[model samples]
Target: MNKVSQILVGGALGLSILTAASAADPKPQDTVDYRKSVYTIIGWNFAPIGAMMKGEVPFDAAAVVRHAQYVEMMSKAAPEGFTKGSGPDAVKDTEAKPEIWTNWDKFEAKMNDFQQEAAKLTEVAKGGNEGAIKAQFGKTAETCKACHKAFRKD
Candidate 1:
């Protein structure tokens, strides 16, 4: 290769390596920020259901179904390991307790149960039966409470 062409190729390779390294080594704060982003989306998706349950807003089955899909997606996401002393920030405003970090297995089981029950509730909502909606919604709420009671701080 000509001298100029060789230099150009070497520069390109160096740039690629730098890019890959940066991508692979995310900072701890960046990881915490990503977790918070996921939590925000999940909270937004759940807000409508909470409002409807409280009778503060009218229920929309289509909205519920869409948000349920989000919930299912989130539930399937692997839990991120928190950086030391980062637990409080990671779970800010979530009913999720620090115990979730301490009792990893139980926390994961509860999360799985939430996913399964939420999926069922989505299916039930699609059936267009008001009575069934009420029943399944109650069940889902209870599931949330069960987890909170065991794992959440007041």
Candidate 2:
């Protein structure tokens, strides 16, 4: 084939590959697992901060900031894991409620709030202000509670 024809054919082939890859959805369980895994990581990272705040553990400012940064990063990622077919009906074992899929807009708004609060916590942690960090961290934790209250199934 001529150069122009070869280039056109190559472009078309690449587009087809990209389209097929995008169209292949993840398994329902995979989606559920992903969201759960993200939450698990967030929890693991958050525990240290909670301990520091409660005085159960020695206050490690650097550790608190690191954990806060991790939570902030993961909060941004958590929403994408709750894809279609990740709901309780599609997965036999999950804590997600049907309302997550049914009332997606509200659920998404809660996720956004979580992300915002997490960001605030990261900012406060960076400032080395224990009081402000504690206050903002409490607010961020409350954001998690709010979402759990609305969406989590026990």
Best by TM-score: 2
Give the TM-score of each candidate. Answer: 0.64, 0.83
lDDT of 1 at 7: 34
Model 1, 55-74: lDDT tens per residue?
68887878778876776576
Worst 10 residues of 2 by lDDT: 16-25
Off by over 4 Å in 1: 1-22, 81-98, 152-154
Q: Model 1 misses residue 115 by how many Å?
A: 1.2
True-structure lDDT of candidate 1 = 0.65
Model 1 pairs in collision: none
- Model 2 lDDT per residue over 1-154, tens place: 4323433553545663333322366667767777888999999999889988998998888888899999999999998888887787787999999998899999999999999999999888989888888899899999999999999989
Which pairs of residues have clashing backbones in candidate 2?
none
